[model samples]
Structure formats: structure tokens, C-alpha cells
Target: MNLKLVVMVFAGALLVSGCSTSKEEMLPAGDHSMLELWNGAEGGGSTARQAAAARESLRRPLTGSERQVDAQGDRSYSRTQEREITQQFPRLPNPDMVMYLYPHLAGGNTPVPGYSTVFPFYSQTQYAMPGERTEAL
Candidate 1:
């Protein structure tokens, strides 16, 4: 008799533990739905229009106080300031040599001097494999 009672109690406990209640069933008494919080009736059609109107009413152009201007005017950079900027950031030696586009090879334009000159150390023969060697011809 005691064995049967223990088995029944275990089964009951398992059943209760496995049961789950949904969110709506678990909610506290007097809790409101999302529609109620938004001041709209449940399943209402006019809620979208009301929401858009509310958003539109919140929009307004910025006033003079909110507007921004360069208050320093042209007084920020004088001749002395310009000279200091140039001294700090010196101009490149050859700005034209820094070409962004590759010129056509057949266009008959010789590459600028120093561009075609290969470094002597790089041109020398170097062993690529255990016994194999290669050099720029």
C-alpha cells in the first residue's frame, strides 16, 4: 500500500511540473493589453492614422536658438596662421609623379626617371629553392 501511494505521488508531481501556463493566463489581475496602453480599442482600424497624426504633431522646424553658425568668422585663419600651416604640412617634392592612373604601355611615354631603375640587391641572383637560383635579367 505504501509503495502504491509513493508511485501515485511521484506521477502527480511529474504531471504538475510538466504543465505550462501561457502569458495571458499567467498575467496578474487588472493588467492591461498593449492596445489599452496606446489608448486604442482592440482590433481597431483607425489606430494607424492616430499614430501617424501623433508623430506628425511632434515634428517641428528648429528655431534661431537651435540653429548653428561659424561664430569665429574669417578671423580664425590669418596670414600668420596660413604660414604656420604650410610649415607644418610641407608640399610634396614631386606632386605630378604621384599618378593615380597607369599610362598605356604603347603610348610611347618613357616612365619618369627613378621609376624604371631596379635596386641592385633585388636584381642580384637569390636562391628560391634548396638548390635553385633566379635573377632579374
Candidate 2:
């Protein structure tokens, strides 16, 4: 009985999935011109003028407080700015190892200029977990 029910359910699922794809879906409807589709029933010059008008309509003169906030907002944010109170998970320092290589020839004896490159000491970088000892030894 259980085997019969399982076989029936599997056959039903297969039938439903197979019937989902129709002959009409497999065939393309009509040939559409690339230029006709790109223009999208509108002239390029009229579309550009409409876009400029929309932009002008969306913009307005800033208020006194908004102007002040706008002036202050520019200097307010910094990527390098450190927050003192938000040190829940302090970063463990990953010291970079700089190596200076002398000029050497390549496979075809191509002259390679002397340059300095930096690489981390550890193969995989690790972060210090919260409340872990991260101080320098």
C-alpha cells in the first residue's frame, strides 16, 4: 500500500512538470527589429528633454536649516574616523612584512626594476574574538 501511494505521487509530480511546457512556448512568436525595440515608441530628443525637465522639477531651493545641515554634513563623516564607545569588537593588528627585491631578469632576461612589496606574515588572516587578549606582547 505504501509503495503504491509513493509511486502514484511520483508519477503525478512528473506529469505536472511535463505538462507545464507547451508547444507554443517552445516556438518564437515573431521577429522583432532591434532598432524599433531600442527606441521604445518615443523620440530620443523628446525623451532627453523630458528627463531634464523631471530633474529640474525634483530639485528645490534648500531651507536655512537644511542649508546649514548640508554644509555640516560634508565634514561630518569620515572612513578613518575612530569611535571610542563602539569598541565592542576591537581589531587585532595584522602586521605587514615588506620585502625589497633587487632588479632581476625574467624568463627572456627582461629587466625587472627593483621594488618593494608587502605580504602578511600569516597564510590566513585571523581576527581577535571579543574579550580576547589583543595587546602586544
Candidate 3:
């Protein structure tokens, strides 16, 4: 009888230890479900109103000093200004070259017959490399 009681206690302890609740599991299965329930059904005008209110809270009128346009209404970029702007911005790196291959049509200037050719053109530089090498045709 004592052994049976000890085995039952051990089994109950194991069951209790194995069972646990995680934060992610404790959270509701679907996100925004509660929000939708509180707001209304899908496509309801409440969402639009909430979005408009959020946008309004985020918006503010521009002051005179913050205005970008000048009195002439022309975008001001003199040679010196343009040079300064260019100096501030850095150029992006060149992308990898892409190659294309096509079947050589018969009756061309070359003597080869039933041969294919490749043409590789670098997209960013718009220049062709000296050799033809590409995995794709």
C-alpha cells in the first residue's frame, strides 16, 4: 500500500512538471482579432476613422522656415549647390553582369555551322565583357 501511494505521488508530480504554459501559447491564437471585435466587423468604417485619427495626430502644418520652396517657386540648385549635394551622396556599387546565349543563324559571315553563341552585357554599366560565361542561356 505504501509503494502504491509513492508511485501515485511520483506520477502526479511528473504530470504536473511536464505540463506548462508558454507566453506565446498563452497569447490569443490570432493577432488583431480582439481589436477587430472591439472595433467592428471587417471593412467597417471604424477602422477608417481610427486610421484617419491616427494620421491627423501624426500630421502638423509646416512653418515658414521649414518650407522648401522659395519665392520664385523654382527649385534652387546652383552649380556650387549641386556640387555640394553630389559630394554628400555616395554612388552605389555596380551589379553583377548578365550573359545571354543564342543559336547562330546559318549563312553568317563566319565559317562555323550549327553552332551557338553567347553575348554578355553588364546591365548597370551597359558594357559587354571580353569573354562569354554564364550559367543561364
Candidate 4:
């Protein structure tokens, strides 16, 4: 009971400290004017230069010769079709193992006929890397 009271008191103190809003001055006030600070010996930030460059780029349009790519119908790069992409990266084949179950009744009452079922050799399907030989040597 005494320990419980101590814990409650500590929690209350922590809660009160957290709830208290202290706006104490960290550093003494500086004795400098805005004009003096602006015209200091050291150079200011490059934001002004960056803003100017952005403004200049927006003002003028790039010439066709200066552009990286010409928007003509004839493109330099060839686009691969879905069929071509599949052919380029063919899927690795997982051999299927066929199993046969002898003729037997599935349930005591039911007379189920025998059938053949196929199962993959691998647990999960696997894919071949691009340019990897998928065909048997």
C-alpha cells in the first residue's frame, strides 16, 4: 500500500511536470540589426541563385537540337511486345509426375472409379532468369 502511494505520487508529479508549460528564454537576446546581418562578410544561402535559374528555365523554351530526344514517329529505341518479352524470358519448366490410383471405393458406400492425376515435381513454380537456358541440353 505504501509502495502504491509512492508510485501514484511519482506519476502525479510526472503528469504535473508534463502539463506545465514553461516558456523560458534559452539564450540572451542578440544585439544585431537585420540590415547588419544581411550585409555580413560571409555569403548568404544559394536559394536566390537557385530561384533565378528556375525562373530563367521557365522563361525560355529549349531548341529542338538542344532537346535530349526528338518527338518524331521514328523512335531510336525499339519497344518489346508481350509475346517477345515472354519469349526473351521463357518460364522454366517443372516436369509433371503422373500417378495412377488402383480401382477402389473412395467411401464405403461410394464406388469411385480409378483415375490418373498429375503432380509437379517441385513444390512451387519456378521461373528462369533472362537469357538463361530453359531447354534441356
Candidate 5:
């Protein structure tokens, strides 16, 4: 019984969808030009008169305050002026120390040259903060 009901509903849906595509609806009724619609010939019968009415509506003179706001509304002004802030003291360079390798055997009793490698003594970098005393001199 359930299978029969499902088959009947499926057949009804197919019949309804097949009836949507009629012969007349497949093509337009006449050769309607898009240019005529753009020039308002087919768009509501009359648009040139409507355009004149819209222009007349906006023909009023602007008030003094309104004119001032419109002239200054687009002109942008910065509240904060850009200026370089001079530091009180010069920036101190990070100190680097050289470590020398003593004359010793490198591999298989082979003597290696005493080469020195320079590295920073401190692991992390230190920066001076504002209003902080970094040096006495």
C-alpha cells in the first residue's frame, strides 16, 4: 500500500512539471527592441516629461549654511598633525663579546687553528623604555 501511494505522487509531480512548457511560452510574442525601452518609449509611455519634472524639483537654491557644509563636507582635515618626536637620548648599541677557542685537538688528534667567534653576551635584546634612566653618563 505504501509503495502504491509513493508511485502515484511521483506520477502526479511529473505530469504537473511537463505541462509548464507550452508552445506559445517558448518564444516572445514580437520583436521588442531594448533601445526603445531604454529611451522610455516602452517604459511607462512617457519619461522625458517625468525627467523635466524631476529637474524642476531640484532647481531650488541652496541655503547659506547648507552651501558651507557641502563645500567643507568633502574637504578632509587631520585632527592630529604628523610631527617627528625627538628622543631625549641616543639609542645604545648592543655590546658584542668575542670568545676564543683554545688550541686543542679537533678530531683524531688533529690540531685545529685558534679561531675566535664573536657573539652577543646577553641572550635577549634589551630596549630602553620612555622616562627610564638607562645610564648615569
Candidate 6:
């Protein structure tokens, strides 16, 4: 019975404390200058309108000095200069050889014609010593 009474008192105190109101500070209203600009309320058009106006705002023709300087700068570099960047290590050439095949019976009973097939004397890739012939036509 004593524990029950203590628990009830604690619960009641907690409920009372939880029900108390806390003081909250209210913030003052701020100036909305950016919002007004976005809405185009200052004689400028709306957001899109302001963007279009801004683009056209700098549409004045370039001055004669600016044109002359730009033309001189553009002529300094040539875009038509051809630069053929060859590989550091050229490919090694392989010698070609002719191979003749005599007419013979192939696959079981079929007689195949004598067709010639040419193949390179060296492999697809071949390495040579420091002082050796490795280039060809």
C-alpha cells in the first residue's frame, strides 16, 4: 500500500510537470527583398522575364577596340596546322611467302583442288636483338 501511494504521487507529479507550458520566443518578420526580385515586383518582369531581360541587357555591339583586339588574338593561333603524331615504336614488318598445295584426297573420299595459300614467314609478332634487321616494306 505504501509503494502504491508513492508510485501514484510520482506519476501525478510527472503528469503535472509535463502539462506545464513552456515559453517560446516569436521571431520578427524579415524583409523579403530577394523574393520580391524573383517575383519581378520592382518594375522588372517575373523570374523568366528577368532572365530574358538580363541576357538582352548586355546585347550592345562590341566596341571597335574590342573587335580589333579579338581579331588580332584569334589570328595568333592557326587551326589548320596538321600534326601527324607517329607512334614511338613502329610495327615490325613480316616477310610474305607463297605456299602451293598439290591436289590430294582430303577428308575421306573427296579430291580437293590444288589451291595456294600465302602466309608470312615470321609470326604475327617477333622480337629481335638490339642490332638486327626488323623493318621491311
Compose the digit string of candidate 4's lDDT tens values, residues 13-113: 99998756645444444665656555552345544556687898889686977574565433545565865777777778989999998788766877878
Best by TM-score: 4
Q: Is candidate 4 or candidate 6 better by TM-score?
A: 4
Candidate 1 lDDT over 22-90, as tens digits, reads 666777545567768467654546676687999999999766655433334444554676677555554
TM-scores for the candidates: 0.21, 0.33, 0.21, 0.36, 0.29, 0.25
1-137 in candidate 5: lDDT tens per residue? 99999999999999999988977788765555767655676654557767788899989899999999987875545232322122444344568998999888978799987889989877776655566666766
Clashing residue pairs in candidate 6 are none
Ranked by lDDT, top first: 2, 4, 5, 6, 3, 1
Residue 62, candidate 6: how far off, in angstroms? 29
Residue 42 of candidate 1: its Cα lDDT?
42
Clashes of each: 0, 0, 0, 0, 0, 0
Q: Mark the regions of model 5 whose C-alpha exceeds 4 Å error after superposition.
A: 1-31, 48-58, 75-137
**lDDT per residue as tens, model 3, 17-56:** 7768776777756655767756755554567667888999
lDDT of 5 at 94: 67
Model 6 C-alpha lDDT per residue in residues 14-85, reported as the tens digit of each score: 999875765542443445576775676566335767688899997999899999999989876645333211
Q: Give me the displacement of residue 101 in model 4, in angstroms.
A: 1.0
Question: Candidate 6: TM-score?
Answer: 0.25
lDDT of 3 at 45: 54
Q: After superposition, how far is residue 118 of candidate 2 from its true place, in Å?
A: 1.2
Q: Residue 97, candidate 2: how far off, in angstroms?
A: 1.5
